[model samples]
Target chain A: MRFINVIKVALRALRRSAMRSILTALGIIIGVAAVIAMVSIGNGAKSQVEASIASLGQNIISVYPGSATTGGMHGGWGSASSLTVDEALTIRREISGIVAVSPEMRDRQQVLANGLNWNSSVNGEDVTYLDIRLWTIAEGEMFTEGDVNSAAKVCVIGQTVVAKLFPDGDPVGRSLRIRNLPFKIVGVLKAKGFNYFGSDQDDVVIIPYTSHLKRIARRPNLNSIIIQAESPDQMTRIQQDVTDFLQQRRNGRDPDFTVRNQQELAEAATATTKTMTVLLGAIAGVSLIVGGIGIMNIMLVSVTERTREIGIRLAVGAHGRDVLTQFLVEAIILSVMGGTLGILLGVGSSQLISRLNGWPVLVSTSAIVGAVAFSAAIGVFFGFYPARKAAQLDPIEALRYE
Target chain B: MSHVVQLEDIHKTYESGEVPVLAVRGVTLTITGGEFVAIMGASGSGKSTLMNLLGCLDRPTRGRYLLGGTDVSNLDRNELADLRNQKLGFIFQGFNLLSRTTALENVELPMLYGRRHFSTREIRERARQSLDIVGLSNRADHFPSQLSGGQQQRVAIARALINEPQILLADEPTGNLDSKTSVEIMGVFQKLNAQGITIVMVTHELDIAHYCKRNLIMRDGRLVSDTPVVDRLVATEQMQRIVTAETDAKLIA
Candidate 1:
């Protein structure tokens, strides 16, 4: 028999029980939808984490002060003043792959501005700090190198600090008094949403490290130093060089710094969401298997119900392979059609959930293609036995069957 | 005249369960082209088994059965199916039309499975022609459930003829029909037979047996008698007489 004719026969048989065919296909529909929805939700969360991590900085390496030893006694990482601002400048001038350097020193204090006072974190940094952190200035401009060299009492305020200290309007070109020292607010930092740790990124006041060291904090040691790598390929080499040079500068003393790169931070941040995605995908896979079994069960029932019909075809000269092909094609058509509809429903529903629940959802083309292909494979896997049974039946016995 | 079917000492045994039951015992038969013959017997007399063997639905245990001058007894499953498609047509007593299918599609079924290819338009045209030959062209679009028993049987006949088989096999074709409908079915067979198509029918009814030109009677898994009918029954005359009697009875009422 011609292949086209076989398809027509299979189609006619399916249409014979249209309601049953659709109901049988519903199992597959739900299975595919669950897979798509769960995977997209997981991807959405992962993307959100990645975006937050990107907000931290691009190609950044951070150096934190390590433990200090005092003759059989030890102080943990941030316990002693271990790093100096002069060393940060020395490293930036020496490293070839280094693009920018920001020596960080954080201290929280009450700041008064425009007849209002708010306690906020004060950070001392370089002019290149905004570029390395991928942050944009919302108003005015950052403090220049001349400001850092002269110890000018100029500062940049973050969005949260602006909202708190200057509620009426822009904080740029204004005055804020830090620890009784009135500093000019030169710029307003753009707002960045919450980080993966659930802490706000836009609640800081930034000043030149020279100003914080000479006028406010009255200290010479620094808290941390942030470095930007010129290219991804050279980040590790630069990080190694900075760590060795800093340790060498100690000259056999207890190491007082730990260096970490951006990739490590991103990996740590995304670990939880990746686990969540795998768990959701596994649960959805179980439903898809159940759907396949449902298809097998319905196909078996159909074969049993159509024994006499099969017998008639056999008697009229249909080959056993023809019968097998017809029934197998029927199952594949059911699953493929169900999978197509499921993709539409899954994409639409995921977008709707994202919109209504205010959650991120990313529907990928590969996921859509994989779901359809998986459903078709399920069809073939589940459809083989019943089709074989129908094909191998004795024609005489089948004809005699009521 | 060329022999359309030649069976030599054919044997069929049913080893289905623990015990073996002999269904056909060394039956020899020959049917020439254009001949109308009927085999009559009681239930369990192996007439159905013989019909199945002749139709290539089952392989005989021993001996050769030649259909259209080709030996088909030892042929494999697919080969036998091909032979059935190329050389034989079958009509069952149950009028086993696929449910929910239109009569036109039922008629097109044989051509769908045949070795020769037919275009969609050609298949449709041929199905229409087959239905037209069976005088069911107007009812082509109607499903089997909507058709009467006689109409459904006619549809089956149309299906059988579509492949233009060398032999037509009928196993109690009129067993499920009332007398008038039976006569109508017989009329169709006789008309086809007159057009030089070979026909073999198995029926328990003696009256239906007489409609054939020759008769063979089986008993105890063996053929007991084979003879030409001296006074054959004509379906057209019987149909006419029935109509005249119905009209006369209505006049009396």
Candidate 2:
């Protein structure tokens, strides 16, 4: 019954000063909305990273040449003297825990189909490269292992390159020119969209690894070695095995080689996303603290304005605790109302982002509950001083107050 | 046999900077059940302070204050609040009706804070009864600001009477009214007092004090005189004649 009267008084006072109450609530609204929006964007970025890492295939490992820069013509070396084709063959034959191996060679070159010509990365790797990297042909067929062995002049074109170079035909089995060397298009690769840096992935051509090493650049060393483990659990052991194998092959000769596992790459990306999420959330939380301060200021003013009213109630039989409860209820109502509105706006904004930019967004139940609870806590914490001040007022002085 | 209020050697001193300003000093008084008493003093004569002490709104700095056999001056804050809720009702000089509340709700305020529960209909009915006692039943829905000073004072009187307190304490209850409104408010008080309700009014007007059966005049926070009015100024019959005469004048106009 006492609580009901407190709410009644709060509602009455709020109605009396509608504009001030709404303005006070606006602070809470902004605070809650900021928290939710920041968290959602954080979650969205995280999921985007996870999707990118997932596309890279969890079973694969990547190896790149050391320094591709030693004594260059301009920007260092054209390619390193490390990672020969012999090493790739040796890893394939000797590494016990390794399930598959694919050596990759890539260079930026101009490729032409009919009259259309564009500069794009032309990657040279075998059939196992596609299997280990989880790349699938969306049309026609892949180059055979025989084609790889023979350094066949056949290629798989990416979606963007296909669209740009062959707008009017299938281009499959059609011959394309890679800087004066002709290669038939064996397949059209599926669209991989963007990488972590928002760079286009569907702009490369894939050809036999030996074709680029022998016929294209005529280089003896490898740029990168890609491998796949039998299972995700064997990734660490397989990484060690491959490292040891390379070291032994080089006669413990400071091989200057590094092996990156899929798990480590995923962990690094997740940690980065988590850090970004916390930083954004902390920035938003500062606004909530400011909003709480606003509540405290307004509550103190309200207590002063209602001092005589408090006295009247006290003289008419309201306890000091009743006065405290009434003002506290008002503060709570303001914060909870603001929190509810902010959650709605935040969720709506996240959905808008997802729709506009095709970014992944998720609004978790915990964030909603957490925002509401945090707003309520702000109300109680900030409302206490004012409520206590009002409650401790001398009734005689308060009654005499103008 | 029982007194509604009793004060023995009450003294209240307020500090103004370093010196203590005596607001009420060495005062003793008593109001038995069913008595109408008026406290009279000049401005700053400590009449308001005396009323506050009588209404249980403030404690005397040093004194024994008993309300209906209970020593109220020694009571704690909560106890005083409970005592005020149960035993005392107040009508102030400014009426002091809660501005936003309707006349009926204002009358019901004391009951709302009481320990008992009343249904909405019951509360409304009781408030209506109190308003009817003050002849403002038709204006139960009117807000304090909407009413005339006399009507507002009557509404305040209704609020004071709703709790059926052991004593009705009125502090300068007619100070804000014109002569005619003052007479009307005093008539209402007289009617309530005739129903055997104890009334203690603090006022400065001689005419207002003359309406009470007993009068106490204060000087420098001390009661200088306590005497019964040999012939009450309004005297019931003369006030009725004047009211009828005014109605006739209004009709003539």
Candidate 3:
């Protein structure tokens, strides 16, 4: 009953100064709105990065040729041609839980078709390369293993290569020249826009590794090997097996290859976005603190302004504790109302920004719940001092206050 | 009649900077139930201090005060507030009614602070009844600014009486009103007093003091005289005489 009375008193007092109350609540509104909107944008960017990484294919591990040493000089990763097609085939036969493998050998070459020439990365890969990388064939059929064994001059062209070399129609079955050597286009790959590194993924062509090794570049070494594990849980075990097998293949000598999994690359990629999210969130949180301080300032002024009213209530037998509760309840009401409004504003604005800027915005449920709960805590924390100050005033002096 | 207030050598002193100012010194008094008494003095005569001590708004510096048989000197702030709520009703010279609030809500204020919970219906019913007793039943919804000075004072009185306090303490209840409104407020008091309500009023007006049965004059922090009024004025009769005199003089307008 006493609680209800104080609530009634608080409500009446708030309504008495409706404009001041609304202005005070506006501080919290902007603070919470900033928090929610900023977090949504941050989360949206994060998920977008994650989705692009996921498109790299699930549960994949890539092995690259490690750095090479000669006396005092050291050549970095990818500088050493330290792997071969024979070693890749040996791993495929020896490793268990392996789904698919693509031994890759890449070279940049100027390709000419119908009197137009363009420089593009020409990769030599196996028949299972598309499946391992989760790339789909858009037109025609993949070159068979028989074509790989024979070092056939047949290839699959990427969307960028098709756009550049064959703008008229489908280039499937058409022939394009690489280094004055003609290679027939067997299939066309679906377009993938770009990776996180800002490099075009669709500007490429693929041919059998045997063809590149035996005919085009005449190199015995493979650039890298891409392997797909059956599932995410087996990635670690499969990675360990591959490393140990490669090391053993080196006859107990130092291995000349570096292994990396998809998750590690994804984590490294998302770290920057995570930092940005926290930075934006912290800046938004500072505004919330300032909002809390605003509440405290207004409550203190309210206590001083209503001194005589406090005296009247005290004289009428209201306890000092009752005054404290009434003021605290008023602060909480202001902040909670602001918080609710902030949530609506935040969600609406995020949607508007997403539409206007064409940016990905994912509003996380946890962030919404956390922001409100934090604002409520801010109410309680900032309201205590002013309320206590009001409660400790002498009724006689309060009555005498102007 | 049983004693409603008992003060024993109550002294109240204040430290005004370096000098210790004694507001009230060695004042002892007793008032029985159903008595309408007035405390009168000039400025700095300590009558307000004595009233403060009596109303339990401030404790005596060096003595004890028993209000309705309870020792109030040793009570804490909350205890005194509860005691004031339950046992005493206070009226101020300024008619300290909350502005913008309806008279009914002002009357209901005391009940809202009371310990025992009253249902909404009961609180509204009792507040309306209190307003009716003060003859402002129809003005229950009127704000303080909307009402006349006398009406506002009456609303304060109604608020004071809502809790059924054993004693009503009025600090210059008629101080802000003109002679006619003063007597009219006096008439309201006389009616409530006639119904056996104990009232303690502090006033400087001799005629206002004359309305009470007993008068205690204070000077220089001490009680100079305590005497019963030889010719007590009845508020109802005084208001009637004023009305008749006005009609005879043609000053009704």
Cα lDDT tens digits, model 3, A174-245, are: 899998899999999998888768888899989998998877778888889999989888989989999998
**A1-402: candidate 1 lDDT, tens digit per residue:** 889999999999889878768966776787788778878887888888788788888789998888777897888887668889878999999988999999988889898988889888898998899999999988998999999999999999999988888789877788999999999999888888676678778888999988988887898989899999988789999999998889899999878788889878787878977998889789878877787677667756666557778888998999999988887888888878898888888888889877887778899777777767777676666566655766687787786664
Model 2: how far residue A148 lies from native, Å: 6.2
| lDDT at A205, model 3 | 81
Interface DockQ of each model: 0.70, 0.51, 0.58
Q: Report the lDDT tens digits of candidate 3 across residue range B15-124.
A: 85699889999999999999999999998999988888888888889998888887888999999999888899999998888876889989999899899998878999
**lDDT per residue as tens, model 2, A1-402:** 366666876787677667768867877787778778878888898898888897876578776655444455422332446787888888889777677888889888999887999999999987887777677999988999999989999999999998889988588989899879999999999889887668788999999999999877788877788888888888888788888878787786765567777788788889999999899789878877777677667656665557777778788877888777777788788878888898999899988977798988878677677766776676666666755765676677777765
Worst 10 residues of 3 chain A by lDDT: A382-391
**What C-alpha lDDT do the candidate models reach, one value each?**
0.87, 0.82, 0.87
Q: Model 2 chain B: which ten-residue window has the lowest total lDDT?
A: B233-242
Ranking by lDDT: 1, 3, 2
The reply for model 1, stretches above 4 Å from the true place, is A58-77, A90-100, A115-117, A164-171, A179-182, A194-200, A227-269, B237-253
- lDDT (10s digit) by residue, model 2, range B1-253: 4887889999999875698989999998888998999999898889999999998888889999988988888888888887778789888887777776778888888777777777768877889999999999999988778899999999989888888899999999989998778888888888888899999999889988989999999999999999998878764665677778988889534
Ranked by DockQ, the better of candidates 2 and 3 is 3
Return the TM-score for each candidate structure.
0.88, 0.82, 0.82
Residue B17 of model 2 has an lDDT of 67
DockQ order of candidates, top first: 1, 3, 2
TM-score of 2: 0.82
Better of 1 and 2 by TM-score: 1
